[model samples]
Target: MINYNPKEWFTFIFRFHKADTFRKLFPLMIAVSLYGFILAYLELEYWSLINSSYVKNLSLMHSVLGFVISLLLVFRTNTAYDRWWEGRKQWGALVNVSRNLSIKLAGYLEDESDRLYLSKLIPLYARTLRGHLRANVNSDEISDLVEIDKTHIPNQIALRISGRIFELHKQHKISSEQLIILTKDIDVFTDVCGACERIKNTPIPFSYNVFIKKFIFFYVMTLPIGWVFSFGYFVVPIVVFVLYVFASLELIAEEIEDPFGSDANDLPLDTMCNNIEKHVKEILN
Candidate 1:
């Protein structure tokens, strides 16, 4: 995420961050403007054709479009925001559960080496989950910490952690019931990982996206026709601005729909991971 002072309103308005919708919609904005110009010229130069009943019927399309498209945009934005917020919540849970696991192990385990080993594993699980959600796993950082040769790093990490709890039970460091209680934390980690994976894998329906884009396209294209009759050449800027609003919203929806990504609008997974590491280490120390 791009961090800056919230009071700097001018910077907020002027800064063109990579995730800014305007930058993504620039080419489409130009196209819409050019189309507006063409419509204005044609309507002004050849008044009779656009003045005909059939061409006038196209104005009715706008009547229904404004209300229907507004609803669709609202739905699209709401859904994407829900996903983004849920992703953050899941990661927050992961952070809490990591701390809990560390504290439990440190208190229950008799051996200092066992406590240290489990403390190291808490962050390893977090690091592995971060890479897992990003769809790019690098075992180099965790290879020594977790001696596992498995594709699903998060699950493998959880398995090893759970296995440690069982190991404690076998050594009588923790009783059978205590073993069950501690294992629940690993289950929480598994559940958190599952929830994150669900968000990362499942996205907004593609057909809905295509339909909304098509609707926006046809609606914007017809704007020049309807408005040019009333607004004249001024419709060029009006149409361009309208396209910017519609296109920018669509672009934003796409960006936030997948919250685990490295995109500017995405949840700050990397920062959260680092913070989790720091907090877990602080507690262990």
Candidate 2:
């Protein structure tokens, strides 16, 4: 995600990042402005609908719909944000679980070979999971460790980690109670993966998303029809500004809804995975 100082309000206003909504919406904003200007000019010069009661009443319709659209956008942005935050929370849990497992293994394992094995395996699980979420698992990364199923790389790594722990218990390297304790942390690895998958697979309803886009389109398109009488030629900028605000909200929502992607606003899966590797190595090696 793009990090910034919250206090630098002026700097943000003056700066325009490539991912900023203004950049994405600028072309559409120009089109909307032209549309609004044409409608306003036609109404004022030729149609002479500026004084018509029907045209005046359309503004009242907009006033009511404006409130309704605000509520819908609020809910849309909130729902998307919830998904993004939940993904972050799941990754946060994975970081903690990796550390806990590594710490326990470091204390329980006596042999240098076993410690080295787990040290590599714990970080491999994190790296594999990061790749799985992005749907671009690197074969080189997987082959460097141990080969298993390619269909589900994370699950294969996780299975290997669990199997090794079980083998240690069988060989009397770690007792039955220590085995139980270690199993708890390993179990959480799958839980975190499943939670991330749920967020990735499921998304906001299709019908609802389409409806919001349609609502914004029609609402902005009709703004010049009614408000031209009041705002006159100035309706062009007013309509464009309104479109900018509403469209920007939708754009931001789309960017953040799938937090696993390469979007600048997405969760920092690469950094988190690297951190997991560093911590595991520090604890176990």
Candidate 3:
């Protein structure tokens, strides 16, 4: 959600402050002290010629470990992206389902009375779906459009919307065949709702999350020592830079994981719902 120019380093770092407050990097400040002490210990222990020679032999082993962790990090990032992409696809389906259901509801009920009834009801269904997806169903926000009376209380807002379709059938209005077709559309719309809820409620497994976090921290801690013999005090900025890259990616994955949250990176669900309402009303009018 951050619109950053590639040339702007200040903007990139500043963007993290605007992300989830609880996930900020202040807690990780301990890494600097930890890296410094660990690297200093490694330097002192390897001061002797024989010990330095042994470390040179261990260099190949360290290289192999680093390569493996790099691959694991890449895999972790891909898994996070899968969740984000799936959520976007579900929302795309929601857009199509809303349009189809609205058109069918209006086209089937051709009576002046029924058309007027559907004019209000179809948009209400979309608004209710939008609110329900966000878990912020504001009755008053929808009150001007839909008449939410006693019968609409407790549960089954969808059933109330379907009740309009049901009425057309009960009055010897729409034929049994026509009713079945309309009911199928509603069923698809319901599936859209359920799919969106599934993505919103479920998250990547916690064990994987814990493993990635530990892996990144351990990798970063060892990095300073890995370079101490070569870069000496220059290890500070290099270590910070590497850790920052790793942290930035971790932050990005976290942001997109909850695509409905208030974070800037979250999907623009409110805007999307409003657009659905606007387009539906335009088509009806």
Please give the lDDT score for candidate 2: 0.91
lDDT tens readout by residue for model 1, 1-285:
667788889877778877788877888888878888987898879664656666666668787887899899999999999998998899899988888877776677778778777777788888888888887888788778676677799988888888877887888998887788787878889898889889889988889989999998888888877767667799899888978888788888888988888888788888888888887777666
Candidate 3: residue 150 lDDT (0-100): 44
What local lDDT score does residue 251 receive in model 2, on the 0 to 100 scale? 94
Q: Per-residue lDDT for 182 in model 3? A: 77
Per-candidate local distance difference test: 0.83, 0.91, 0.67
Preferred candidate (lDDT higher): 1 or 2: 2
RMSD of each: 1.8, 0.9, 4.4
Q: What is the lDDT of candidate 3?
A: 0.67
lDDT of 3 at 23: 51
lDDT of 2 by residue, 26-48 (tens): 99999999999899989999899
Q: What TM-score, over all chains together, does every model reach?
A: 0.93, 0.98, 0.78
Candidate 1 ranges beyond 4 A from true positions: 4-11, 47-50, 53-57
Candidate 3 lDDT over residue span 1-285, tens digit each = 544578877766546445644357645655675666666565756443334665445446657876877777677777777777876777677677667766766666667677665656655665676667666677886666555774322125567557878888999778788788878866766776676677778877889888878877877777655566666667676666666667777777877776765568777776766777776666565
